[model samples]
Target chain A: MASVLRPAAISRQTCSLVSNRTALLQQASRTRFSETLRTSYLLRESRCLSTTQRKSPSRIPSNDPVAAPFHTSARRQILPPGPQVIEGGVNDPAPVPPTSPTHGSYHWVFERAMSAALIPLTIAPFAAGSLNPVMDALLCAGIIIHSHIGFQSSIIDYVPDKRLPKTRAFFWWALRAATVVVAIGFFEFETNDVGLTEAIKKIWTAKRKEDSYVEPVLRGVA
Target chain B: MISQRFTQISARRVFAQRSISLTSTRFSAPALITACKPLTQSRPAATQTVPEDEAYSILKAQRAVRPVSPHLTIYQTQIPWTLSALNRITGIILSGGFYVFGAAYLVSPLLGWHLESSALAASFAELPTAVKLLLKFGVALPFTYHSWNGMRHLVWDSGRQFSNKMVVRSGQVVIGLTVVSSGALAVYGL
Candidate 1:
């Protein structure tokens, strides 16, 4: 009985060892097959690259086919030599100096005068009694002009006023019309209609009185 | 023979279970493995041209369903409501101040006409002292509130009073200053 059991156990152990060896052999074969495939692929790539390099000697100067076309095109498009005489000739028209300095001085003087005028003008509305129609008209004109200019400046600065031609023209026309209307109203208010009407009535009365006196003198002479 | 067959079946079952366990262990590698596969599979094939209609539909869906971040509308009103209300009130007072200044400047010059043609002094003398005091107080309240609140805004400009406690304290200080200054000015007729 012991002899039979011992042979069976040894046979089982040998079978397990044979299976382990088969698995290791299969893994080694797979690794070798993959390595051979990689080597063949690399060789094919290198051969194709070398054949193309040999065909185009002028284009592939550095033996790098990827950079060949780029370098050739860049050399072909290089700029030609420039003009021999760089400086201007006497025949060329003289360059005019800019008028910015004159403009700057004018702007400075104008700004100073306007700023001085504005300080007194801001308080003028209050100082000029409300009953004085002439002063009121002047104050109204100043306020309207100030408001219109301020509005136009702000619109120009912040809005897309310049981008749309129609809107820009509309704003320009609106500002001009507003100025005309305000000016007409201000002049109408400033005129002395009451005094003028009274003077006309007095002239008519004096002419009637003279006519009555002349007719009486004629009757007395007859 | 039956016992031998049973032992062979048990050995095969044990090996199958071991292989299944090894396959299960692969899932524990990382979350990126599962995440990347779906993304790659969902991409459109490079060779296929998508219909323009379908492209437009997809873009429209993307535009409509895109997430918007939370804003002030999402937060419930609490202490911030008080601050916003105070700001609005101050803005209204400032606008009213412009009218007040305009009327005063325009009418102050007409005071002579108004006093002579109208019974202005007699009307003022008829009013109760308490009403006179109230009118005086009304004039001082707006100026004091505006001045105190302007100072608080200056503090905010300097970037302090950011914390919730500081906000509450500053609000209290604003109220105290407004009441104290306006009341004192009104009483003293300053």
Candidate 2:
């Protein structure tokens, strides 16, 4: 409504509604003004009041239901973790600088694409009837990276920068170190042991170690 | 005529006094006082004049009385949040297992432990049938559930079936699939 109303657009005949209470008080105080000037001023005030007709911003419909209730200050003051509205006036934007979509728009796409890609990589080894070393490596890398990203996101959400900056930074570094160590461990397992998929397969099928080499089709590699 | 005119004036004064008496008797004292109150209104809450800077501290003190919004306790046990929590737990289990096993494997050369494929197979073979089945089921359940729900999350990322009904239904489907599939894998030991 502030943006809607234009003070400069005030007509010569109509009331200058932008004129503050002091302006009205000044007019009321002046003894030199005739009855005609007083009548015009009173008429202008009445015209302005009649035009508005008790309209307010709250009366305007808003699409955002959650925010609509807190649009007013008194109700907003009751919100949790202390008053969010206390930092600024009701119409003020958040303290953070405006972010550009170009910086992070592809992040969602990349994450989704990577997550989707892992699904195929999971079954491709089994589908091929024999686990290729390259495919196995791919699966391990994908799963590890996916898990790392997932954990990172979880930490970011649970440990916000605003409340616990130091804690968040510590966790961030700890997660990075853990991820690196985990990658090295995965590499060792892949290179030396029967690899991730094959090892899981062997463990799952292990009975009495006598038939430990049996495949999905009951073919013995022994 | 003069006596009649004086009587009229006395009668008017008497009527005014009677009305005041009636008002006092009919209404409560608060109502009478409200009625007598002038056009200029007094504030509802008692206030003291304070410095502008000091006023902020009063506001801060008042703000402290309010509880945080959307508290976990305030929410009823709902499917979407419950499933999301399960997903987090399962993810933790899976990833944590991966990291632990990976680290152990990396350090195995230094520890001189036999973490070889044959060694693992033989050790796993030693476990009782029930234990083996339990372990397989435990591992498989989380894997299948996480896999299925992760797919559901992928679908959500694509911005389809976003309604509460779809999410609840999908979560149920994920749970059902996990139970059936993991149980089958456990029994078959495949």
Candidate 3:
């Protein structure tokens, strides 16, 4: 009876130890699997988060946000393509602010005034007006400067004007001639010994006197 | 027996009162409990994917602004240009003015007629007021235009408003200021 009882107890203890060992192994495997699953889930979640953040669209689309706020709303809207839609194909070379309309009108007014001014400019010399010579000189100098500037501007804008070598040559020659004549006239007037009108009258009188001599000589010969 | 029965009745009464109070509390808070559900349901859908070249193609399809050609044909004979031409003409005129002035000055001393002085005086007296006024104004116009336009040029010098709009506006302002000042001087004989 003692031997049979001892064997029974030993078998029972071995069975219990084996069962405990199997249970311990199973729990260790489950913990490792769960840890691996958790790590994979974390990696997937991080990747998804990064993708969303990077793919988000910007609210304002324009490079020049300050100048063109309307472009943002325009970019958001959808419409059918057409000729008008084709306008948006290229990023408009940064839009140049429109030139002021007032400038054109101002130019027009200036042109009119300048036209009207000619009448006075032309009349001034003949008016025999008691103008201060200094003032007249100043005025002439100013006009010369203005013209010089205008001519230069024209040269820049109209390169073709220069390309026509003959036209350019003629213009320069005419300008030089005008300058010389004016200078000579100015000096002559400054030193003239008689009034312009008196000088003319004297010439007339001398011609008459010469005529009178011719007639007398002819009569004497006859 | 009497004590035991009293304890049982008291416990039953307490249980019934607790049930009535719980029911009333739940009814009072029903609206508050249901509020958050609709907010979660109303979230917007996620954005769809797009092709890489879509933006580039859209930009390419847009129209380009053509450059404007300068119009030199019309009013080619206007003030700015006319003034340029007059610069040449004025040289001739000044020579004549000097001759006239000199003749009158020099001949007046020898000739009793003093043709130069009288001519100078008579010329002034003979001119129409309108013409005289116009000449007076003309004298000032060039200076005024130059000064005002010079300021405009200076503005350009500073590298501000170098745009087409500003250039045009400034050109106009220069002209307007010139006209107003010139007109005022002509009327006032300043």
In TM-score terms, which candidate is top? 2
Off by over 4 Å in 3: A1-163, A184-222, B1-121, B134-143, B158-172
Task: Give lDDT tens digits, candidate 1, residues A6-63.
Answer: 3333333333333364564455445544554443333323333343423322332343
- Each model's DockQ score: 0.02, 0.17, 0.03
| Native contacts kept (model 3) | 0.00
Please provide, for model 2 over A1-222, each residue's C-alpha lDDT reduced to its tens digit, 9 standing for 90 to 100.
Answer: 111222222221112222353454345334223433333333322323344443433433343121112111122223335232256655988798577664467766777777898898877755764467888888889888888888888998877776567888999999999889889988888887777788877877878744555444375334
Give the better candidate number (2 or 3) by lDDT.
Answer: 2
Which 10-residue span in candidate 2 chain B carries the lowest summed lDDT? B37-46
Which lDDT values do the candidates have, in the order given?
A: 0.45, 0.67, 0.43
Best model per DockQ: 2
Q: Per-prediction TM-score, please?
A: 0.27, 0.61, 0.29
- lDDT per residue as tens, model 3, A1-222: 011123332323333333364564455445544554443333322323343433322332334211111111112113222221233325667556578756566754554444344345434543653234444444444344344334434444443442355655666666555444544443444345343333422322222234456988999999
Question: Chain A TM-score per candidate?
Answer: 0.32, 0.53, 0.25
Off by over 4 Å in 1: A1-222, B1-79, B107-126
Writing each residue's lDDT as its tens digit, candidate 2 over B96-170 gives 888878777778889998777778887988898999999899988888888899999988988998998999999
How many residue pairs clash per model? 0, 0, 10
- Selected candidate, larger TM-score, 1 vs 3: 3
